[model samples]
Target: METSKETSSNLVKRYQRYLKLEKGHPENTLDAYLRDLDKLLNYFQGEGKSPLEAELEDIEHFAATVRDLGIGARSLARILSGVRQFYRYLVLDGYIKNDPTELLESPKQSQHLPEVLSTAEVDQIQQAIDLSKWEGHRNKAIIEVLFSCGLRVSELTQLKLSHLYIDEQFVRVMGKGSKERLVPISPRALDELGYWFIDRNQMKIKEGEEDYVFLNRRGAHLTRTMILIMLKQYAKEAGIEKTISPHTLRHSFATALLEGGANLRAIQAMLGHESIATTEIYTHIDTTTLRKEILEHHPRNIRYREEHKL
Candidate 1:
């Protein structure tokens, strides 16, 4: 019998190939699935049982253990989902006769909405960039496209100049799972991109990187970490207090559209959400905005606030 580490490594590689080639999962999803599987493999090793030999009780115990570890409901659910997919693949490829994970239940999902930036805050972040510097145009354009298009950081990094339709005002984005979508560009964003291109053109362009829309001074594509660090620096300079990330801009984009009366389904398509339920969190955000307005300006609430003032 092979050792747990050796057997699990071979199976994990096979599972990865299946997810990437057959299921068309993107790189991030592939990595997540692998991480999820590793957790189970570690548990199985501790119990001196092979993953292929796991029984229903073994799976149940695993789930219970994860819950007891204080993992969040959303993450626990995804872990179970990943494990199920792995077993289903095992059953298909003849490594196992039956999937032991079939009856396992994911935890009930909890809604953890991300913070949304106000339009003024978004502008303040952009304005924090100094245009006199060489990289200023590129950084400003990055912020503009992020808020304007509501793109995932990966999608933004993979953006290409060839996919841009300046005349039609749409940029073709290759989004999650290798899916493609055309997102409209605001004129303000377009002007920023135009400025960026002028800076981009002056560089001694690196081969194979010329087609990529956002490149560093070394003439290579920007990494996701670079984007995060840049946003943090600008946010501090802008004096905005809310915790920010690329997804905060994404949430802001969706919330602004919802408040401006854009259809929910349209926002769903723009955000590339596979489900409308994923996009519906903004409705809660919209409601939160309404409640704030009532608390601040409603006649009854105003009088209560004034009376309660110490």
Candidate 2:
């Protein structure tokens, strides 16, 4: 029989290789899994036990301990998922007799809806920007591109001038998995982008930051946190109460496109969603609008009968 330490070392090597080769998990995901497993290993060590020696009861005890530490269900679920994957690899590789976490269950989490802003509210926020200032033009351009593209904050910040195809009216976005997708750019957004680009050239850009589209006063790439701060200030100036974030702009963009009768598949492609099912969440059918549509188009409602002699 393999020693406990030897078995653990082998399991760790196999887990890392599995994540890299078989699973194709991203580096960040691999890091998170390693961290979670480290915590489990540490707990086992403190209790004078080894992961190979751990049974269902030990797993249950670990879950109870984590719950008592006040970790939320969603977080606990993620931790459990990491642990389960590690053990599954161990079992498949014949390092363990049976999967110790075969009965482990993830905690249930509540479904939360994405926040969105109304068109009127979006307009009010845009109107609040003072266009006279140079930064105002830049800010307006930022908002337009954000809503027009449905980009994540990181994507927007990392945007490059070379990605814009103003003549073709489309911009190439680098999304998750390093995948690239083309999103249409509105004429207004293109025009604003033109002005921002002109102003951008006037600044003395740092050596390595030349290609970045959005820049700070120092002419470096913008950060995600800075975008949030900018949006918050704009929201406060607009006096709209609904909480807003850079993501809110993305949500508003999707909502606007759906309301304008854009095709679901086209929207999914534009949003760079890997799965169409993920994109389907954005297709919210308003009951009030559906009722109005029925009233307008229903055959029985449309058929008018003249008063007949009785």
Candidate 3:
């Protein structure tokens, strides 16, 4: 029997397991979601409410209390989402006949555009590399691949030599939830990879790690934190002040292609996005580019120019 005191804790553990094994969420995401759930459960505990005993009014009261406590709209939205997902799991398991969160809604998140580097800025960072170092070529290849392919940091770290199809002009990328897609390789990226491979082939690779694409000086695979630290170092050296990461490169790749008139669906496929909506965010990144094209090519602008004879 599930007691009121233990119900929240027990259900949260079950939800945690479900998120990990069944939903396949990454560790960081799982931890964040679990933390959100804990906050909700603890709030209910103070109100003497069990998971089953809680009503929509009770949840709303908690939301109001958190709002009064000064939780920002975006964070409160995520907390509500966590509660919503937890209740969803309960409904699925027959623990609840109706979800109390069915009528709940997340607050509208502020549209914070992702940071993107221009082609020149990207070149500036690449040129800052110390060519005398053995890792110089390797780091250059990493940057080229990141900006060219729009891969997430985890995908970049997991990249393997076997996944490269350079001769065919494509590289296989395993994205979230192990979903795989073939992203085309740019000529510049391929050239950098070639130069790096020359040094990579000579390294005393670790046993059973021979198939990895980008390894450290010790011939071991690079971690996500290492990639982040490396990007920060290069950004500082290049004299560019914008905070950046592998994801910035990824965003830059998509934004550049969009600015170059690439099809949204084509970008979506290359980025391995399951939803077109997720890929649509790139369209909102730079209205200035779109405005330029409009003024340069719009029929009204062309007619006005011809009429003015200037």
Q: What TM-scores do the predictions have?
A: 0.59, 0.56, 0.59
Candidate 1, lDDT over the whole model: 0.78
lDDT digits (tens) for residues 124-154 of candidate 2: 7889988877677788788878876678776
Count of clashes in candidate 2: 0
How does each model score on lDDT? Answer: 0.78, 0.72, 0.77
Which TM-score value belongs to model 2?
Answer: 0.56
TM-score of 1: 0.59
Please give, for residues 48-120, the per-residue lDDT of candidate 3 as tens digits.
Answer: 6786776665676678678767898888988998889888988887777788887554554664455789888
List runs of model 3 lying over 4 Å from the truth. Answer: 1-35, 38-73, 76-111, 276-310
Query: How far out, in Å, is residue 60 in model 3?
Result: 27
lDDT of each residue in 1-310, candidate 1, tens digit only: 3333447778888889999999999999999999989899999888888998886657867886787678888888899999899889888987778787865545656545667887778889999999999999999999888887788877898999999999876788897547776677666678889999999999977899989999998999987668878998899999988778776788787777777666665667677664345645543444334334323432323434577671
Clashing pairs in 3: none
Model 1 / residue 138 / CA error / Å: 0.6
List the candidates ranked by lDDT, beginning with the highest.
1, 3, 2
